[model samples]
Target chain A: MTPEQFAARRQAGWAELESHLAQARRGALRSVPAADLQRFGVLYRHAASDLAIARRDFAGQPVTEYLNGLCGRAHPLIYRGRPVRPSALPRFYASGLPRAVRAAGPYVAASLALSVAGVLAGWLSVRLRPDLAATLIPDSLFDRMARGEVSGGIGDAPVAASLIIGNNVKVALLCFCGGVLLGIPTALTLLANGWVLGTLASSIHRDGIDYRFWAYIVPHGVIELSVIVLAGATGLMLGDAILRPGLLSRGDALIAVALRAVVLCVGVASLLVVAGLLEGFVSPSDLPTPAKYAIGAGSGVLLYSWLLLGGRTRRAAAPRLQLDAGG
Target chain B: MLPDLHEIRTADNVGIGYDPAGIGSRFLAFGVDTLVQGVVVIAALVVALALAPAGIAGTLAIALFLLVPLLVSVGYFAVAEALTAGRTPGKRALGLRVIRLDGGAPGLREALVRNIVRIIDLALGIGVVVMFFDRRSRRLGDLAAGTVVVREHRAPTAAAPPGLPPPILRTPDAGPAIDGVEHLGNAEWGALRTFLSRPGMAPDQRARLAAVIAERLCERLGLAPGAPERQWPPELLLERLYLQLLPRMAPAPPGHGMPV
Candidate 1:
């Protein structure tokens, strides 16, 4: 056919498509029922050129296949020249989200290790001079802390528990929200917070808060720290998306990462909220040393265990792209 | 009382396009894409860390400057998908993007809900496993978010046979009708073809297209002259063409012009 003829035909097709689209937008059109499997099946079975030429909205094959599956027929044909039967509702939470988490596992571990080392270094500095708490910690705050007033007085069992809950939640939110600036602020916030944590633990120990600092921290520390690092990791994820949008335009890439970050933040925030309630409400009063150890240890096991094992829910399987020999 | 089945359905005209890459190729592609992204992320971290001090100062520097912005950007992806088109870089790279099943981009609120439910995708770490059993390879995240990831690209196709007649098509019935036209003109047809091949044309131009076709059709079909302002000239032209060469081209209106 001549160029002119092709152009005219193309126009005619597009015009038809537009009218159909507009009608749908105005709610003048409703989805067609999947009553005629045979007709729909024809479209599915021969989708390549025919459907591509016919339907302007079809993106690619996955969509075609998805619609086919949803239609429960061999194919999903256009009814009234509009895509009446689509695949099932789109799945927004990609299965790849976990893969994303796992992909950053090593980075998270390294970040946490750096934090732990910083804490140890801070502790050593405090050991050399017990009264240094007065120097590093504010004098007014030090006096209050020294008297066992804040949370539960350093070694106080109940205070530690409550602190864990509240502190973790705040850290999580900070980590998640700080991504607005592309992760720089969140990273800084985490590092600063970690520094403070390290300094405080060491200072309290120097003040005779009990060398059981390890024991006190070990219980909920795993979950608490993991959540923080995860938040940082998520923040990093967002920033990376912006810096390198890859195939997506910068705006599109940024938006995607931001979405994932929000989800991560929400999850982490919930953790912190739970942690705070534990510290404020449950971790103030003194308990038997054995009970303290038991509670602390129990909490760590439960938290980490939940993180690792929370995937056994009844959701559908993740999408797997497979290739096979050609016909 | 039906005729032999052999006469009813034939596979000879059936067209099938297949991807022979196998599961391994797909996995490798995904891995490569992931690794590239990973390297970039690490590089950003290093830059951030280098700028910050080693102790608290360094840590805070990195967090404030690097980490928070990253998180916020990811949140933006969620919002964009909900607000604009349902796509992210990774998604686009994988040859898969998200869209409301009905059509068009999702709204901002849907984006919020979809991203928020990512927690459910992490349930027991079994979320990823959902893809294994899903027909469309949906994970728990997709299920919770109400989205899908489709293949991003398709291989090229072989050339069409030379000297084949153009596929016969009937004008869409819903639009206004143009009188005094029997067949499409060469220029109008050419323009229509160009419009179809390209993306995003203005509404008024698209609307006026039928009139142009109707004018051409009048020349071809020897129909009466009618004002361009009246009804859809292209539809009338198309009606003439349907009556001539291919009577079966006109199908009953599928009642598809959006619901009233």
Candidate 2:
């Protein structure tokens, strides 16, 4: 048959499918009448079959191109990703986050170790040569310490909380994404942050207000630092995918690890929210030093317990349909 | 024979092809999205600050100033893509949609991952460079999320003039016989069909293009290139050749060459 004759015979079905798709795109397919919904499926299958035939017989023709596009548009409607459920969020916190963290334990440990190395380097450098503290610590912070203030001069708790949250989340995201460059940026970020902490601590120690500084920092620092470490871990995991992609190609490996890394990032973001709240409200408050330390230690325990033990008894959740992102 | 056609097999065993959006369109879309995001953030901050009462409510305004832009930067793409099943305002304007490698709409998780990774992709024009090297023009976010941005097929415009009618071929006995027509590939056949179906060409230009195509077809068929144009006009010869090749190009009947 001529291309025109073939198009004439199939045009009605294609038009029907197109209309159904338009309706589906506007709202949900479920909104369509039952009879029409069934017809939509049938029409889609027919279009799919027609696409196959056109690809074989009418290759390079506009008819084939049209059929291919029709099917491409319709395929996603037929095969959607798993629907979002309210339970998914709660379930993720209870198990998904912890499970992913455990799965990527080695990377996290490496991240922690890198940060510790930075801390030690900064601390030892400052301790050995006190003059180094001038360069290592920011001038505003040093001047504040040189005087008698330990608080961050945050006037409004809510404003500071939002700013802290924004900054922390940005840093976490940067650390996570830096893994694409083979983990160099991720490592550097962790070390740089840790070095700043160490230098500040050394400077505070020299001023004899080390205890006061810890009281202020520990309330939020415990969770904030952990979240940063977790973020670094996610980045390292991405880097590992590039560095040692096992059997898969480098792109495939990056994708495979990214799924879990993103889940960890969500957890990191959640923790940073908590930390930011504490930093803005609790850390700067006139609370007793012992009480602030207690809050820090208690929260750390709660956080680790959740990560280490939160969904151990349950069987794995039913596998939901996850669409692969690659071709 | 279209370039950059990314094909995936569906559960029905049919191959569906997607045309990946190229770097130029995606960059344009990004530009639009950035402008939209900036406008939205500035407007939101203005309204938020304007509404802030004194004392406690004023703190909220300050907080909004710090948080609003960051949230919008990440949330804008993620929420838009998730809600629209793959398109943001910019993408829709540019006729692009994001889909999984397996040709499914991205869910919220995919959307979040894709956008969060955009931090790196947007840094220092890294995404553009990465897309340059990637076959599907995927940036780091797409590679990580396993998704691709594809150009949507535009519906035929009503303003377009009606296509020319198919060329009629004389009966085999009435016309000069043409042989070895099957040797012409789809490329040659497609060129002939395009030449025949197109309208509004100057007669002289049409005759010239037809002669060129007919000569190529003659050379492919092992006949003297100039001989066929002598007996029949080059356009007439092409129309006849198109009709002769039609049956050979028709797909096999169902259950013969159909995908199982």
Candidate 3:
């Protein structure tokens, strides 16, 4: 039959569905009469049939586009149902976060080992010739440390907290994004950070106040350093995809690891907030050395417990993607 | 030609095809979002500075300067994405929305993951370089978050389209005279041919679809519903209907549109 004749017979049913859908979109679906609801299903099925027929008979016509749009609009109402729950957040922290971190554990281990080696090399170089520390430690930062002004001197805890968090997050993101370049950039960023840390340590030791510096850093360092490590690891996964495609092609391998790496980035970013708060207020406070040490140790235990044991209640299955082989 | 179409399978097992927004469209959307974010950050800094005490100095001043603006810039995407339920103002303007592949709404975690990974995409000229390698035109953020940005489909706005000509029936004649076949109309006759043409479907689906077409055709044609002649199933009934209608259905003018 001609498209017009098809429409002539079915337009009334389509119009009825249209009115019902309008009401539904307006959040008035509950008030829609039961009779209309029943008719909506029949109309939707008929429309689906029309679409199939249109593809076969009316191909390349405006009628096909109209049917497709109509079906597209109706499909969600017919089939979509996934309720957002408050419990999902708790579930993610409990199971999703750790499972994600563990999945990228090998990458994280590689990042850790690489950064540690960078650190040892930095320490060795700086210890052998202390003057080289000037190159690693920026002059402004060195001056600030010398004058006891390293905390940005802003009295507002929030301001300090935000700065610390923001800076660390940026560095973490750089470490992560750098992985896109076959991971060389990622490794370089991590090494740069590690070398900087080692140079700073040696410079602080030269001031003969290394003990005091440790007390100031330890509270936040415990959490902050670990988060950076995790981020570096997550970033390295990008490189791993390019470097080791495994059985999958390079593109597919990248996609495979991208999900887990992104998830890890999410978890570690949250951890950075905690570390930032500590660095802002507690690190600068004249709290005794032992108290600082205790806080540092306490956070270490807490962070590890959260990562290693928080989600041990069940073995969550990883999500699997199903790709269609097209005809 | 580039293959930009990707299909999302609904729970009903129907595949819904949507064209993912291309990188060019995405960059435009990002440009809009970034402009808004930049204005917000500047306004915030202005307020912070105007209200601050002159005595403020040292690490605190530097900290506030560095962090608050950064938070606003990044948080603009993450928080707006969540509260807007997967669209920022830019996406809303562009008629784009981030949707979870699994069919649910884009949740907070997915939003955060996608937005954070966005920074990485931004480095490569805002996903321009990365999207080409993806099947769905996804940047790193989308792939990682298992989300896709699709144009929000609009409902049909205009009148229904013109009719199709009657298909020339290829079925060898199915028995002699099926009664009351004239009321079936050209469209109904075309529909029967459609049902006959679909091949290689699973047996059950084919039978079910054939039955539905038969029932609809019977209702439209004023024929007795169901298999009155039990020996001849609906598919066979359909074959007979097409055979009877082919000669009777009128043909349309040449050059009327038909799919190749």
Q: Which candidate leads in lDDT?
A: 2
TM-scores, all candidates, are 0.39, 0.88, 0.69
Which ranges of candidate 1 are over 4 A from the true structure?
A: A1-101, A117-135, A138-170, A207-219, A243-265, A306-327, B1-260
User: How much is the lDDT of residue A109 in candidate 2?
Assistant: 99
lDDT, candidate 2, A44-111, per-residue tens: 88888888877776677778777887888888776767767777888988988888888889998999
lDDT of 2 by residue, B132-230 (tens): 998899998998888999998875432331233564343343255586666786667766777777767898998898888877777788876456444
DockQ ranking of the models: 2, 3, 1
Q: After superposition, how far is residue A63 of candidate 1 from its true place, in Å?
A: 30
Stretch of 10 with least lDDT, candidate 1 chain B = B1-10
Sequence-dependent TM-score of model 3: 0.69
Give a tens-digit lDDT track for model 1, residues B1-260. Answer: 11211111113232222111223333454465456556666776777679665655554455444433334333555644543245444443554444433222444433554554343344454545666666545553444334444433332111221112333345544234334333544333433433334445475775476567655555665555554433444545444344332322223224322211
Judged by DockQ cut-offs, the docking class of candidate 3 is incorrect
Worst 10 residues of 1 chain A by lDDT: A72-81
Q: Model 1 misses residue A326 by how many Å? A: 22
Query: Ranking by lDDT, best first?
Result: 2, 3, 1
**Worst ten in a row by lDDT for model 2 chain A:** A318-327
